[model samples]
Each structure stands twice: as structure tokens, then as C-alpha cells.
Target chain A: MRGIILKDLYDNFCIPKNAAFYIFGALAISIGFFIPSEYYYVLISGVILPLFGCCALKSPTEQEESSSFNKLLITFPNSKAQIVTAKYLLGLGFVILFNFLALLWSMVQVYTHHTIRLTEALRIWGIGISISLLFLAVIYVGFFLLGKRNGTIFFITITCLIAVVWGASSALLGIQTILSCSPGLVICLIFSGAVMIVLSCLVSIGIYSRRYSTGTKNRY
Target chain B: MDYAIQVKNLTKTYKDFTLDNISFDLPCGTVMGLIGENGAGKSTFINALLNITSAQYDQVTILGHDLNTQIKLIKEDIAVIFSDSHYELSFTPLFVGKMLSKVYKNWNQKKYLDYLKRFGLPEKKRLKKFSIGMRVKLEFAAAFSHDPKLLILDEATTGLDPVVRNEILDITREYAKGKDRTVLMSSHIANDLDRIADYIACIHEGKLLFIRAYDELQNNYGIINCSRQFLDTLSPDDIAAYRKEAYNYRVLVSNRQKLKSVFTDVWIENASIEDIILFYTKGEKIR
Candidate 1:
């Protein structure tokens, strides 16, 4: 499992995807504030940021190993479950790294505005990370289930669900309830992130537990 | 004795196809050739053994590791290669020397360098640019660099020119002579198998058609050529498979020596893997 992650990270972050990510991160910090602070930035981070993370899925170079190696892996003295854990953990590490960067950028936005104080900047950063974490959960599982191609559809579905929740809570009850519920936002965000992570983990583990090989594994 | 691989009643199901039941054993230090027509479940069988499918129903053991557990350690000594062209030299020969050493604990840098130079692969070119033959050699270099005890080749010689194919087969044959390792190769090319495979396993329509020592498999089956009228007397089941030309007929039989005696007047010819596949496959269509 460690070997798998080392290979993926080597292929992804250490080399290929890292350059793009660092450049994207720097660019996001430079240009994210051009639009108003609320929905535009949130949507971009919630949606586009996770797409970069999804592309980081480190599959074997062979895509799928033949039965000889398949048998080799299962009987290799390490649990396939551990293999799953290492991959997920490596993914989580990348998510954390990305999460912190996005959070820092969001805080800078909060600090640039005189309305929110430094402490409020931290609170907003916390909420941003929570939202990104939730997005990661939903997107990662979506990647596992729907695959990389159908991920955009999954994110759009999640977006629709979030819109419905926001609409129902604000429209049915009025914006007064939202103002009153401001203090509880972080908890709510944490709960949402937890649910998405648990849901994605369950689905991903189910896919991994079985010998699930996807894509055109045969080279020719 | 610790076998290189042992499979019993391994089954994998798909929507359109099922690798019905596959069982074979490749003892330590022997190569087993898996031969089947395209989509005949040769790749599927390999996939199942590799635990690639989600509907996991199988009993497979490889490299003294039980398929149900110990997958990682088992993987440590195993290498896999696919036949496309020369394998990608993603990194330079120098870079591969260092990077691969990190993956395969036993990777021998000098041996890898020797293979790269011997194969005439440029250390500087990224594998994406190499010819098919060069790419395969690089894959062979990487695979052997680790000093793997068991090598699983998935159609590694399928589409190469005869010269390149022969070279690849010779490398594997040389690898086998050390008598401490095994290679399981899947190929659509029978001639490649005929030249090197010690054992042969045939799969047809998702079933283990037969697994036999290559010498025995070849020795057992022969073509019994006869006219249409004479074919009427033979039981269809006795005819494993057969083909028909304008005036002559080519039939594949399990006991060719005995069948020749039964049809004493018919001509019998030596059977190759292609003949057996063509005979059975074409015969099934006619029947």
C-alpha cells in the first residue's frame, strides 16, 4: 500500500500534477478576489479545486495487474484493506495540503475586507476548510463510483442538493433564521463534511474490497 | 514444495461473459503458456487471478502466497509485462536504475544498466517515444531488474514482428534456464508458445479447455484428414474440433495416434496450436 501511494504521489504531486497545482494555487490567490467574496469563490473552490484533486488518483501504471500479480497481491502477506488504507491516507494528505492552502487564501480575503476582524478571518478559514473537506468526501467517492469522467455530473448533483438545502432553509424559514444560525455554521459544516467523508469512504471501500479493476487494463 | 502458482475452481462473472472455472498450477521453475483466442477469457482469467474484477470469487495462490491474503509480499517477487511495443522508458536508464531500486528491494542497478545497453535503448529518450520493440525491452529490463522469481506476461509478444517476437521469447527462455523462477505468458501467437513454452493451458469460451505439458499437448493432438463421407462415421464429440477445405478436411482429435488407426485410410498430420484452435473454433460454427 505504501508502495502504491509512493508511486502515485511520485507520479502525481512530486512531478506532473504538482506543477499545475502550485501554479493554480498561486493564481487562485492572485485572482480569486476579483469577484465578490461569497458565492463565486466558494463555488470555484468547492467545484474546481476538487477536480484537481480527483485527477490525482494514483492507479497502477499497468492499470490492472494480471491474475499472476493479482494472486501475488492478495497472498502477498499484506491485506488489500491496508492497500486501501494507504491510498486513502495518501489522498487525505493531499486533501489536507490543498485544504490548508485554500483556507489560507480564503483568510487573506477575509482580512483584506475591514468588515471581518482577524478572529473572524480564522473562523471563516475554518469554515472554508470544512466545506472543502466535505467537497473532497463527496468528490472522491464520486470519482470512485462514477469514475473520473462522470465526476462533473456527480458534483453538479451535489451542487443541486446544496442549493436545495440552502433554498429550503432560507426560503421557507426566511433569511432571519440564517442570521440567527450563523454561530452554528461551523458545526453544521463539520457535520456535512463528516457525512460526505463517511459516505465516500464506505463507497470507495466497497469498490476497493472487491478486486475491482476499472479502465482498459489491457494495453492492446 | 512451494508452487509458483496454484489455482482451483476460480470463477469470475461478468454481464456478457464469465471465466467459468479456471484451474492450473505452474510449479516453481517452469513456464506455463496460456493460449486462447481473443476474448476467449485468457485475459479475463488473468484479470481474475490478479483480483481485478469486483465480483471476487476465486481460489488463487501465487509465489507461495495465498490469494486470499498476503498480496503485498507475494507482489515483491513478481513482475508483469504487457506487449505493446518496446516498453516506455519513462525515465532514463540512469533514472530507472535509481527509481526502480526504490520499488523492488532486490533491484540490481548494474543488471538493469547492462540490459539497457544490451538492448540498445537510449538512456536519454523517454519511453513514450520508443518503438514497440524497444518499449518491450525496457519493460523486460524493468521486470528483470527486480530479480523477480515469477514473471507474468500478458500478451507481451502478441503483435511484434517475427524478429522482435523471437527476441522476446529468447529472453524469457534464457530467464527460465536459471531454474529458480517461472514465467506465465498469455499470447494469441501459438508459434511463440511452440518455441518456448514448457506447459500450455488452453481456454475457450470462458472455460479451462485443457492444461497440459506442451510436449504432451502437441504429442496428443494431431489432424486426421478425411473426406465428408468418412466424417459421418466419426462421433462429433470425438472430434475436438476440425476444419474443412474445398476437397480435404482437417480434424483435431485428442487421441490422434489411436484415431489414425481407427480411420486407417485417412491422412494424419502433426497439429499445432493454431490448427487446434482453428479446427475446434471453425468446427463449432459448422456444427
Candidate 2:
């Protein structure tokens, strides 16, 4: 399992060019938002954080298709379920790594400028990461079930779901109810995130097992 | 005889095609060549053996283990190479070697590196930059590095140049020289199989047409070129296929020894594997 996850990371994230582009792009984007100094942290975090999640969502499947390596992956000694589990775990790893880095950077900014309170930044980071987790769970299930070709359809469906959730919660309950950083709300979010991860993991494993067991699609 | 691969009543169906009840056995320590025209279920047959695709089977076993139930255990000792390279384009030989080291328990890093050096592949060059032949060589290197007991190659040499194709065939032949090693390679290039395979299995239209020893085919099959008038005197049962043009008739005989006395005046020559395939697939059957 460690080897499998390592291979996935090696394939998707080990490129120097991609690393440079993301890092430099984030720094350049952050510096470009200089007009409003007070909004610097918010702008940078908003742009880079979701981009990180999207990258996490997109990398493995896109690389699997373009490289034609997924066909070879099944030929490995690992079981089908193991491969799916490794992928989900790799995604989780990425989510954790990205959110942690973002939190650390936010801490540095708060330390230097003191414009944002530590708790406020922590809450924002928590909410953003939780939302990213939910987003990834849905994307992971879609990619596993429909494969790479229906990626656009999956993205559209996810976008619509996000929009519906926002509209319904904001209209019926209140925006504050959804955005509040209460302990109860945080616990609820964590439980739901855990549930989504577990459910997606199982479904993805089933999807991959059926596909590989039947030898249906060779590339994906 | 101890068989390395024993497939029985294997069937796979698509909307328009069905590999119906295919069965054949490949003995241990020998190479078996699978030959077929496009869409004749050659790839499907190979994929079924690898369990890369699911097929209905009464029983399928590889290396003494059931392919369906014990594939995880079986795969450790089996190596497979498809027609195209199945590696990431961005990966170099060094990276691939590192990745595979964890996948195969018997992976020999030294052997893999030796293959890379022998194949003239640079350790740091990305696979996307390698020529098609080089990419295939990389795949072969990886396959060989694991020291698998059974190698399943599906058209692995199809698009390679003659020199590279011959080299690949030689590698397979050497790989099968071990005490228990075996190979099942599929190709339309019958001459390649003729040079290395111990047995040849021909499939046509999703059916196993014939699975015979290579020596038996060489000894029994022959082609006779004679006048149309002389062909009329021969029995149709002896003629597997025939083509008539102008004043002559060319007949492919399945039992060449029997034809010697039956067609005493006709000149018969040994049939090449290519000639045999052409006759079976394209020539008109005598009866």
C-alpha cells in the first residue's frame, strides 16, 4: 500500500516543472493583489487553496489516462481494492498536506501583521479544507464510476450540487447557520467528511474491482 | 505432460463477437504462438488469460493456480506485455525501476538496469522521448526483471522493425529456456513464430481452428502447384484449400505424406507457416 501511494505521488507530483509553476504562480498571484493590503491573506488563500484541491482532484486520473499507465497498474501484484484504497488515501494525503501548509502560512501572516485573529484564520482554514474534502469525495466517486471521459459531466454535476447546497442553506436556514464556526458545527462537518470519505472509498473500490475483474476498460 | 497454461471452455462475448468455447494447453518449458487475423479474438484470448478482461470459463489455470481465483498469487510469477507501452510518459528508466521494485517481490534492480543499458536506453531520459522500439524494450526489461515463470505477450512485436522484432523473439526464446519457464506470444507474423514457437495455435473468426505442434505442421502441411486437370482427379478431403488461375491449380494439402502417393505426378513443396495461414484464412476450401 505504501508503494502504491508512493508511485501515484511519484507519477503525479514529482515533476519539477509543475512544482515550480504552482509555487511561483501562487507567489506571483499573491504579490499581484497589492492594492488592498488588508485583503491580501483572503485573496491569496482563496485562490491557492481551492486550486490545490482541484489539482489534487485532477492529477491522478488525468495522469492515468494521458500516460496510459492505468492499464499497467492493474498488472501489478496489488489487488484491485488495494489500488483504489491507495488512490483515496493519496487524495487524503494531498488534502492534509495542502491545508497544513496553508494554515502555517496564515499563521505567519497573522504573526507579522495582526490584521486577522488566529481563531478567525483557523476557522477559515478549517471550513475551506472541509469543503475541499467534500468536493474531492464527490470527484473521486465520479472518476471511479464514469471514468475519465465523463470528467466534464462530473465537474458540472458537482458545481450544480455546490450551488444547490449554497442556495438551499442560505435561503432556508440562514447563511450564518452554514458559516458559523461553532464547536457543534465543526464536529458535524468532521463527521460528515469522515462519512463521505469512507463511503467514497468503498464505492471506488467496488467500481475498480468490477472494471478490472471484468476487463472492461483497458486505459482507465 | 505438465502444462503451464490450461484453459478450458473459455468464452467471451461482445455485442458483435464471441470467442466461443476456446480451449488450448501450453506445456511447460516451451513457447506457444497464437496466430489470427484482426478481430479473430487473439487479443481477447490473451486478455482473458491475464484476467485483464473477464470471460466465462469452466476452468482456467496458469502455473498450477486457477487464474480467476488465485490470480494474485499467480501474477507474481507471470509477466505480460501488451502491444503498446503502458508506462507514464514522464517516467524515466530509473523512476520506473524504483516504482516496480516495490510491486514485484522478485524484482531484480540490477537485472533491470542491465536491460536498460543493453537496450541503449538512458537512465534519465523520459519514456515519451524514446522511440517506439525503445519504449517496448523498456517494457521487456521490466517484464524480464521480475524473473517471471510465464510470459504472455500479445502482439508485443507487431510494429517493431524486423531487426528489433527478431531481437525480441530471441529474448522470449531465451526466457523460455529455463526449466519451468513458458511463453505464449500472439502475432500475425507467422514467420516469427515459425522461428521460435514449439507449438502454433491458429484462431479464425473467434474459433480455435487448429492447435498443433510446430514440427507436426512443418512435416504434414504442404502446397502443390499443378494443372487444373490433375487437381480434378484428387480427393477434396485431402485439399484444405485451393486457388485456380489460368491453366494451373494451387492446392494446400493438410496431409502431405498421404498426398505423395495420391497425387504422384503433382509437384508438392513444403508449406511455410505464412502459406498455411493464407490458405486457411483466404483460400477457398475444397469441400
Candidate 3:
């Protein structure tokens, strides 16, 4: 499993081409610091960071499919469970890294500009992490079930849907009003995201194992 | 005699085709050459043996371990090479070595580096820049570095130049020097098999035709070219397969020496592996 994760990271993250994404992400967060406090969370956490995370999340699957590495992966000593779990763990690692960056940005705002309270910033950070987790869970399930070609279409469709839903909710309820809700709601959202991720991982394992066991030609 | 691989009643079905019930035991310390025509289930059989595809089987034991229940243990001692490289194109040979080191518990880093150096594969060069021959050499380096008891190659030498192919064949011969290692390779190139294989296994249209010792094939199998009257005098038991030409008939017989002595008027030539496969697939069956 560690070997698989390292391969995925080397293929997708630690490469010259992917350096562009990191540069773009950093630039987006830096620009968000100058925006107003209420809009800062929406731009940095909602749009830029999740969008960046989604690209990062989709890369390894695409590369694996293109290179037929998944076929080779089945020959390894690892089981289907370990293979599926490695992808989820990599996603979780990305979510934590992005969330950590968001937290640091919020802290700088709270100390330097005195525009947002630390407590409110923490609340937004928690909500952002939950949303990222849910996004990761859905996209991974799509990649595993639908395969790489159709999964790319699914990814684009889901991204558009999320954008539309976020836009409508922010317009109707306003960002401040939604954030003012009880902390219990954030906790529930985070727990649900965790549960969904676990379910997604299991589904991926079953799909992968069944594909081979049934003698269906693996798409990857 | 001990065996490295024992497969029984193995079958894999698809919507359009099926690899029908096949069974064979590859003895230890010998190279078995798997020969078949296009879409003749050569790769399918290799896939079944490696568990890359799920096939219904009564039993499959490799290197003293059950394939179904002990595949993890079995995989640790076996290495597989396909016609093309399966590693990501962006990966350098150095990265592949590092990644495989973590996957195979018995991976020897020093041996791997030595093989890379010997094969003249650049450690830092990405695979996208590699020639096909170079890519195959890299796979060989990795396969040997792990010290696997069984080496399975599926069309691994399909498109190489003669020199490179001979070099690779020599490496396989060297790898099987001891009585503890085995090699099962499938190839369309019959000459490659004739050069190194200890036994030949031929499959035609999802059926096992024969698995004979290399020496037995050389001494027993013969092709006779004669007139229709001469062919009619031959026994059906001696005729395995034959093709009728415009002027004469070419018959494949199992007993070359006996037929040679009996038929002084006809020309009997020693049959190569290619000739046997051609007759089996394209000629008429007699017995």
C-alpha cells in the first residue's frame, strides 16, 4: 500500500507539469487575502481550494488508466482492499494539506488585518474541510465505478452541480446567516463526510474485485 | 519429478470466445515454450496462470503454494513480463526501482542497480524517452533483481531485433542454469523457442495440441513430401497432419526414423517447431 501511494504521488504530484497547479493555487490564495473578510472564505475555501483539490484528486486515476498501471497493479502482492484504500488515503492527505493551508491563511488575516475573528475562521475552516471530504468521496466513487473516460465526464458534471448549488445557497441564505448556525451542524457534516468516504472505499474495492473475478476486461 | 507449476481443469469464458479446459504441469528447472497463432489463447492461458484474469480451475499450484489461497506468497517468488512495459511513462527507472523495492520484500537494491548498469539503462531517464528494446531490458533487470523462482514472459520478445532477442534469450538461459528456477514464455517467434526451450507446448484454437520434450520433437517429428500414390501407402497412425499442394502432398509424421527407412523414394525432412505449428493450425488433421 505504501508503494502504491508513493507511485501515485510520484506520478501525479511530484512532477514538473504539476508544478503549475501548485503555483496557481498559491497565487489564488494570496489574492484572496486582499478580498473582504466575508467573501474571503467563499473564494479561498469554496471555489479555489476545492477546485484545486479536485484536479489533484483526478490526476492519478487518469495517469494510471492512460499507462495501464492498474493492470500491472493487480499483479502486485497487495489485495484489492489495499489498492482502493490507498487512493482514499491519498485523497485524505490532500484534504488535510489544503485545509492546513486554509487555516494558516485565516490566521494571518485574523492577526494582521483584524478583519475576522479566530473563532469564526475556525468554523469556516471546519466546514471547508467537510465539503472537500464529501467532494473527494463522490469523485473517487465515480472514477472507480464509471472508469476513466466516463469518470472525467462525471467529474465535470459534478463540479458544475456543486458550483450551481453553492451559488444558489449563498445567494438565498447569505454566507453570514449560514455560518451563524449552531456548531452541531458542522460536526454532523464532518461525521457524514467521514462515513461517506468509508462507504465509497468499500464500493470501489467490490467493483474492482468483481471486474477481475467475473472475467470482464478491465478498462484500466 | 518435482514441478514448478501444476494447473488442472482451467477454463475462462467470454461473450465471444473461451479458453477451454486446459491442464499442464511445467516441470522444475526447465524452460517451456508456449506457441500459438493469433487469438489462440496463449495470453489468456498466461493470464489464468498468473491470476490476472479470473478463470474457473479445479487446482492451480505454483512453487508448492496453492494459487487461490496463497497467491500473495506465490507472487513474492514470481516475476512476470509482458510484451509492453506497464509502468507509467513519466516514471524513471530509478523511481521504478524505489517503488518496487517497497512492494517486493525480497527486492535486492544492489542487484537491481547492477542489472540496470549491465543493461545500459539510464537510471534517471523517463520511460517515455526509452526505445522499446530499452523498456524490455528494464523489465528484465527488475524481474531478475527480485530473485524470483518462476519467470513468466508473455510475448516478451515479439518485436525486438535479432541481436537483442538473442541477448534476452541468453539471459533466460543463464537464469535457468540452476535446477531451482523455471521459465514459461509465450512467443510467436518459433526460432526463439527452438534456441532455448527444453519443452514445447502448442495451443491451437483454445485447445492444447501437444506438450513434448524438445529433443523428442526434434527426433520424432518429420515432414514427408511425396506423390499422392506414395501418401496413400502410408498408415494413418503415422500421419499427424498434412497439406495437399498443387503437385504433391506434404505429410507430418511422428516417427521420422521409421518412415525414413521405409520410404526411400520420398523426401523426409526434420520438422522445426514452426513447421509443426503451421501444419497443426493450417493443415488437415489425420489422427
lDDT of each: 0.66, 0.79, 0.83
Estimate, for each residue in B168-260, the C-alpha lDDT of model 3 and write its tens digit. Answer: 999889998866899999998899999999999998888888899999999999998888887788898898899999998999999988887
The digit string of per-residue lDDT tens for model 3 on A143-212 reads: 8888878988998998888888778888998888655756788788889988988988888888888766
Cα displacement (angstroms), candidate 2, residue B94, comes to: 0.8
Clashing pairs for predicted structure model 3, backbone only: none
Q: Model 3: runs farther than 4 Å from truth? A: A54-57, A214-220, B264-266
Per-model C-alpha RMSD: 6.6, 4.2, 3.1
Off by over 4 Å in 1: A10-18, A31-84, A102-116, A153-184, A191-195, A210-220, B54-59, B83-110, B122-124, B218-221, B224-245, B248-268, B280-287
Model 1 docking category: incorrect
List DockQ for all candidates.
0.15, 0.42, 0.43
RMSD of 3: 3.1
Q: Model 2, which residues run further than 4 Å from truth? A: A28-51, A109-112, A116-119, A149-180, A215-220, B227-237, B261-265
**TM per candidate, chain B:** 0.89, 0.94, 0.96
Give all TM-scores, in the order shown. 0.74, 0.88, 0.94
* Comparing 1 and 2 on lDDT, the stronger one: 2
Q: Could you arrange the candidates by DockQ from highest to lowest? A: 3, 2, 1
- Model 1 deviation from the true structure expressed as Cα RMSD, one decimal place: 6.6
Best by DockQ: 3
